[model samples]
Target: MPEINSRQKTAIAAGQKVLNSVNGTPKCLVFTSPAAAAWAQNDTLAAGQKIPAGSRILSNCAVSCGALGASVTFDLGLRHFVTGAEVDLDGIASNVASATAGTYAANNGVLVAGGVDSVTTVDTEPVLTLEAANPTDDIQIRVEIWYLPPG
Candidate 1:
């Protein structure tokens, strides 16, 4: 077997940190609807991993308008089931003028504890919420969250 170089060794160490949960990991929540109304929750994280306070949440939203002259406005964020408080990540508004297809995309990030560096006790398994103005319109939303485990 060949010997590993210094740079390769460093890369291996970084990967190990992520595998050990020292570094943050990526989690994805996807919601799709032909016509969606009302607030909906995405699938929760796996049993071992829970979102803690001060964890950074990155959001990306995409919307596809089906009908001409149709529009949809929606907010995507994390909602703490216990407190019933939500943290908004991104809002997407799209309008289709003509019969041609149209799409909207946006990106943003937010810390779980409202910019506070310290962790809060209320932090728990967070569910992604999609609040839509026009839920009857065709749209699909996907939110990705990267977070470090809470100590």
Candidate 2:
């Protein structure tokens, strides 16, 4: 007689197989500017980090102004260090005074390709620009990027 596996065992094996099909894990990259002076300035968050092809990226941003009645704008994106061509990720325009936050993701979680990925050998990083209009006040901006690697 041949031995048979239980129903519970069969289900557990199937679940494991499904999980194994999904490769890589979710990772996060963060960029912050403390005491950013009024006016326009650019900051680097992560630099020269290896990101495999076919990976997806998402970003979130938060800003706080030192004084009221001051408007701030921020642009976040990925920049290729060698080519200097930026892939725009998200933008926060004229945020309210005090504190505000925003979240952004790629179009339907599309994978990174074309020039966004490293053409040579090294990896790329995220860049953020903050622009403030009027008054002399310090602003703080924080950006977070979430990505999933390919299998």
Candidate 3:
């Protein structure tokens, strides 16, 4: 018998199949939220210890007051003995708008936490999809909308 997938599962499967077709082989965007500064940490690392230049990273803060948003700075460090590197940023994503009253776009490529957002005006080489919130500290996210590898 042929297997049947539910609507939601079907949607996800279709999305994954499409992404897998891309030339660069897309990776899922990851998000992290913190209730306090102490909770935020650069614990995750890029797979395979290497990422190309045209790659991108997006980040945002989540808050319940004053349109609070998340921000991050990234940098790369090289281990003396391990021979691996890290990514560093001074101000990767910060002060992104957030919605307070109703359900809002969480991580759509076109929208930020709040209605205010940033788009890839041009085919910039490296882009990082950031996080968006519904105005609560209970959640933190990293959004990966869609990626088309560089030609």
Task: Identify the candidate with maximal lDDT.
Answer: 2
Q: Judge candidate 1 at residue 90 and give its lDDT.
A: 28
TM-score-best of 2 and 3: 2
Instruction: For candidate 2, write residues 26-47 as lDDT tens digits.
Output: 7766655555554443333343
Q: Which regions in candidate 1 have their CA more than 4 angstroms from the true location?
A: 1-22, 31-50, 59-69, 89-106, 109-121, 124-133, 137-148
Q: Distance from true position, residue 55, model 1, in Å?
A: 2.3
lDDT of 3 by residue, 1-151 (tens): 9988865477677774322222355544333334443222333222223223343223232222222334432222112123332132212333234333222222322223234323222222222222333223343433332333333
Q: Rank the candidates by TM-score, best first.
A: 2, 1, 3
Once superposed on the true structure, which residue ranges of model 3 sit more than 4 Å away at CA?
Answer: 1-22, 38-51, 55-96, 101-139, 145-151
Count clashing pairs, candidate 3. 22
**Candidate 2, after superposition: displacement of residue 99 in Å?**
6.3
Worst lDDT run of 10 residues, candidate 2, spans 106-115
Measured by C-alpha RMSD in angstroms, how accurate is candidate 2? 9.7
**Model 2: CA > 4 A from native:** 1-23, 34-52, 59-69, 89-123, 132-137
lDDT of 1 by residue, 11-82 (tens): 777783322233455444344443453322322222122466644444334434343222323333445545
Model 1 residue 59 lDDT score: 33
C-alpha lDDT (0 to 100) for residue 145 of candidate 1 = 39
Candidate 3's TM-score: 0.26
